[model samples]
Target: MSSYLYRLGRSSAAHPWRVISAWILLVATAAALASSFGAPMRDDWDVPGARAQQGIDLLREHGVGGFASARVVVHDREGDPLPSAEIGTLTERLRGLEHVADVGPARLSGDRDTAVLTVQYAEPITHPDLMGNIEPLGGAISGTVDSGLQVELGGEVPDTAGEAFGGTGELVGVGIALLILVIALGSAVGAGLPIAAAVAGLAAGSSGIALLAATMTVSTSAPMVASMVGLGVGIDYALLLVTRHVEHLRLGHDAVESAGRAVATSGRSVVFAAVTVLVSLMGLRLAGLSTYDSFGLATAIAVVFVAAAALTLVPALCRLGGRKLLPRAVRRNRPLRTREPLTARWAARVGRKPLVWALVSLGALLVLAAPVLDLRTWPGDASSQPAGNTTRQAYDLVAAELGPGANGPLTVVVPTSATGAADEAVATLRADDRIAGLEPVVTTPDGALSIITAEPAFRPTDERTPDLIDDLRAALPASAEVTGWTPFFSDISDMLQERLWLVIAFVVGVSVLLLALMFRSVLVPLKAAAMNLLSITAAYGVLVAVFQWGWAAELIGVDQPMPISSWMPILQFAILFGLSMDYEVFLLSRIREDYLRTGDPRGSVVRGLSATGRVITSAAAIMVVVFLGFATEGDVVVKQLGLGMAVAIVLDATLVRMVLVPATMSLLGHWNWWLPGWLDRLLPTVRVEVEDEPAPERELVGV
Candidate 1:
């Protein structure tokens, strides 16, 4: 592997412009074909399961060409049981509108604060853009509604449209990320590199996923997740290598020599980091669930792409640009600034109280992580019009005025039994204490099953809803089955919990083993695994505080609290575990390099931390912008993903990398580098990191 890398560097060095121009062309081609080559990453885009498929199938069959239609519940602030005269008037007006084939037999429930209206579209349900009918409905209803009524359209149509709306957010987020890079790196070239790296790296990641998506149903969250993870790490890797190259060139080394040194150092670190992150992410597959499996594959592929680009494309770019990369004054005074410093002042603090700093930093992370223990996994209510819109106001006013379950129903598909067993199963569910209003599903004589709609008093993940499913599952006779929105949600939750440990174990265990083999010390991998886990927990805690607890939704632009994304835990594990290691590997590899050369454990950490810390932070600050940018997104899936990762990166860089690591090393002393005598004797000490200045630059023959 080392030989292969060496050869690559040599080849890239010889035909530097070719390598550079190749990457440029590749990136251009990728951007041009991005949408076509890498399809949008959406959940419902191709949801599986017999239930979801059946719904789509039924919608298509019914000639709803657009999709199976859903009812929009426009709320009336005046109350659910608005005067009968008004209900009749409003219903007639909406029913008469174009594309609205049928106005639901809407009813004001006994509570008198909410109503359900069924809408049927005239176009074929599969008409690609099914929501074409819905937009007009919202516009017509919003304007035509009596002031007292607040409108909400439930069912799949609005949810799908809401998700589509997030595509706009993706573009907005990209621009914001670019702006942030300029602020952090202080050069448009520097700022642009990360975004460019991300664009290229993630394009490759998505292309890889297209292969996976073709074969298996990836978790809906995979693309959203891999995009951020790949972008952050890709940029971090590029920033480290590029900045180091720039620093080298400033010292009088030609672009080729500087590029070589930067790669020899930062390239090594980026590879280590990428490998570590890959191990961490693959651990999620240990959970043995599809959602996590999707996460593991999506992120692992991205790590490899980013790491490759960092070493190959970045160096090539530096060499291609030549003297143009350096500032004019630096070109004149290059030799003075380029000389390597033996060690910074802070690196000399190796003998300080490592334990004190370690504990202090660790404790701070624990505090930030504390709130996650209280985390509520509420599925955020899906709404249209900023949360305050009449639709939202009506939703809140009605939900508050009536009760929580006043929202629309969860759709469940059951076997159509002429013997009435299917109906009995539903009746059994309606009789359960957990459910509110249950509706029968009408099926064609052809035997296509339909969904029974029901409103559950508790949240989707609420125990009552799952318990009700259990009761119905028990009540079913031979040849009968029941599954819909709530049951499927329950199954997914149960699957996640059951598989979470496997993922954690696999991710941690595999990463540690790999780290151990690479570094030849058990402590190296163990500390990394522990520190990464700590970072993740702290991030989740932050997620709970903000998105879950609704602490500062306005600051982040979230209009309301939402239930956690169904796939968030796995997404969190896949992205956070992978990324935490990106920084961990960056910092650790530098320390390892120092330790190997100086044979001083304490001295190694100090110099290593000091050297890598600033770069890590610079990389993180750029990532924070990308992440926080998406926090403004309307999609709950994107928001949770963005905030969760952003929070994790911040905590990892500040607490885990900067403070906690130093303190722990201070306390452990030589123990940090300990290896058993017999094992040490058997093992050939491989220099994974070197403390010495890069050996006097070595030149290679012509290509």
Candidate 2:
């Protein structure tokens, strides 16, 4: 693999124009097509094969919008009855919209101060343009409102708000990355190479996502998430190779030869790191959610492009710039290797007291991970919405006028055969203290099915809400099923929780095997896996504290603490594990190379730390900034993802990578590279830091 990459790098460097032109053409074409044909992004959380889905299908068959409808809340804020004339006009206007099929009769509160209008669309509410089709309706109604009354849209339509990423995050992330690169590389050309490669890779990846959306259901957050991952890894991946290439140039190697050597060594590490990340992301398919599938696949595609750019484009840039890549003053007086750096000294100290350092790091991780015991998962609730958002205001108004339970009422579907059971179920449901109200039962024309609305006293994010659903399910007849956003969220939460272990096992098992093959070691891969898990667990605990426990929620730019998104832990585990493994591969591979060259294990550890510590730290810093930028996004789910990833990467880079890894490897000593003869024979050799050279530069044909 290393040799192949070396040859590809040599070819690309030899024909820089062809490489640059091909990449430009590919990205430009993709961007053009994406702008014209890109599929609209939507978040459809409907779980296939669940009772909620069945109810949705049944609802659609009955000429209703099923589970998809917008609720228009009309209220009098001045303690006067709402204008019935205006309310009637508003309903008619909604009913006249292009996509609106039916508007339910306005149901006024006892005081006639609040009125609720349910606008059902003819098409599936999941249609991307549903909001656009009815946006004018909101404008028309708002124009009719006087100082005495307020009209607002809520439920599904309002829920779709804040989907736009606004490019602020990407710009901030890239800006921070560029700053870091400039500091580390000390040359504008050297720094710009990685930034250019990252931008190209992200552009291609985003175009691919837009195209993929045309045929599949994709989360609106997919593009931002993919960019977040792509830019971080793309820059870091190129940075490692660029750093190595500059070193070779300083050693007096020509442009082509230096680029080739860099690609052969650090480029191989990039490939292995990217593969590890892909493997972890692929595990998301086991999650059985469309959202997971889109996120996983989109990110995987982005990583592939970035990895390719790192291997081919970065080396080409190296050849193009040559010695000019370095600052002239620095080039004239290149720093020479004299004494060991602080990182080397730190490694030696850790090596001398491996047991103590390992215990301390592990203990700290365990303390941070302790909060996972209380982790709870649910879809974001009204409280999680941004401050001053109409959705949040509507949610508050409706809850205050009606009840908190009215925010997400559970829909109970009963088969006609169980009419008698339905009566008993209704009695049981009304008897429960959690039940706030029960709407009159509505049945199908032939009485084949019945729908009962049961409003819970607690909000959807409340823990008791899910418990109530489970309790109601058990108390109701077998033919009766619970459905609605509240119940559907519960179902999704349960499904993700069930599959979490399976996905973790698959990712960890395969990652360990892959690492073993690459390093020809058992303990090393196992140690890496364990450390990755520790870092992720610590991140999970922090998520629980910040989002779940509501600690410093305002500081995170949220209104309050909310239940962690049901799929967040699983997604974070997969992504963080792969990313954590990235640094592991880069660090361990360099350590292995030095170890092979010198029989002294301790000396090799010190040398490896000294050689790659700055680059690794810089890379992790870029990743941290990218993740944190997304963490501050307006959307709750996106914010959770950003925070979880950012926290995990910080811990992995500092605590796990800097402290635990060296400690464990130092303790393992020569045993770190041990591979049984049988296993060694079965595993193909894959070196991340190959020492072998290719044929002489003159003999290479492409040049």
Candidate 3:
């Protein structure tokens, strides 16, 4: 594998333009194909076999409330009753709009200051043209807004548009990454190479995601998530290869040979790291939701393209830049570092008291992870959106004028043949004090099915809302099934909670197996898994504090405390666990390389830290910056993912990698490299770093 990569790198370096042109053509072709053939991306939260889905199926079968609906809220700015003439005109306009089946009569608030016009669509929200109605719907409401009334659209139809993926976050993240690289690499050309490679790869990956949407259901947020992962990993992967190549050039190796050697070593680790990420993402399939599948597939595609670019384009660019890739001081053949690096000194100091360092770091991680014990999760609703969002404004108006429960009305579907059951269920619903209101039973014209709407006294995010769902299900007859957007989200949260453990086990187990094969060590993989879990749990705790506990919520634009998104833990575990392993692989592979040559465990630890510490921290800083930039996104789910990942990366790079890993490995001594002879014979040999190659002399610039 190493030999193949070495030859490939040398060939790419020998013909830089050829390699460069091939990448350009690939990216352009993907973009063109995506533009011509891509399907529109949308969110589909269906849980196929869940009760909520079953009820929806029943409703759709009967041609009733299964379709999408939205609320056009009109509020008088001066707290007076709205003009009836304008309200009636807006209602007629909305009914005439495309896809709008009916506009129900306007319901006034107690104060008569706010009115809600319920617009029901003929098709479901996922229909391609359903979103098309948004523009016309806006046009229909313009005259009302032109009057002295505040108008906003909310509910399933308007919420489907979600938050747009503005390029501000990506541009800011990339700009910051380039700045960090310039300072670390100390050469304009050197700094730009990785950014260029990352951007090219990200373009290809994003185009591929669009193309994927043509063939399968892709989430609206998939592109943004892919961009986030692709940019961070792509730059980090290229940076690793560039740092190694610069070290070789400083050691007097020619550019072509240096590039080959860098690919043969650091490139090997890149491949392994990327594979670990892909493998971890595969666990999302166990989540049994299409949204989860799209997240995993989208991210995996990005990683694959980014890794390929790192293996190919970075080396070619390195060769093209030649000595210009080096800092002016280094190109002048000045002396490199004359003293031990601070990382090496720190490693030694920790090695002197491994037990103490390990215990302290472990304790800190545990404290950070403590909040996860109180973590609660729910699928996000419009209420969780940014306050300025129209949906949020409508939600607030509805909750203030009507009850919070009015925002999440539950649908109960019963067969007309079970008239006795329907009557009893309606009675039960009306009797429950938790039920704020119950609508008259509406039966099909042919009397095949009956539909009942029940409003709760609490919002969807409120704990009692789900409890009411449970209580209603228990109280209603077996023939009556409860379902709606609110119930569907509740079911999704329930399903994710049930499968999260399985996802964790699958990701961790597979990663450990892969690491054991690569390093031929049992304890090493175990220790890495444990450390990764600590960092990930710490991230979860931080999420709970900020998002759920409302600690500094305004800092991230969260308006109030809400349960963490149910999908966050499983998704974060898969992505963060793999990303955490990236630093682990870079550090350990170098340590293993040194240990093979010198057989001095403690000294190898110090030497490995000295060799890879700066590059790892720099890579992590770029990742942290990139992720935190996305934390500013309008979507709360994206914000949670971004902030959680950034925090995890910081903790992993510093507390876990710099402290806990070294301390544990130092204390374990020879056991850190030990593999049972029987197990070693059974496992296939995999090398993350080339063993026979000579280590390059250390250089002062970044390496």
Q: lDDT: which candidate is best?
A: 3
Model 3: ten consecutive residues of lowest lDDT: 694-703
lDDT of 3: 0.89
Give residue 670's lDDT in candidate 3 (0 to 100).
89
Q: Residue 268 in candidate 1 has what lDDT?
A: 71
Give the least accurate 10-residue stretch of model 2, judged by summed lDDT: 694-703
lDDT of 2 by residue, 137-202 (tens): 567576557544787778876676644565687578778888888888888788889989988888
lDDT of each: 0.65, 0.83, 0.89
- Segments in model 3 whose C-alpha atoms lie over 4 Å from true places: 694-703
Task: Report the lDDT tens digits of candidate 3 across residue range 626-690.
Answer: 99999988989889999999999999999998899889989999889999899988999887756
Model 1 residue 571 lDDT?
60
C-alpha lDDT (0 to 100) for residue 285 of candidate 2: 91
What order do candidates take by TM-score, descending?
3, 2, 1
TM-score of each: 0.79, 0.95, 0.97
Best-performing candidate as measured by TM-score: 3
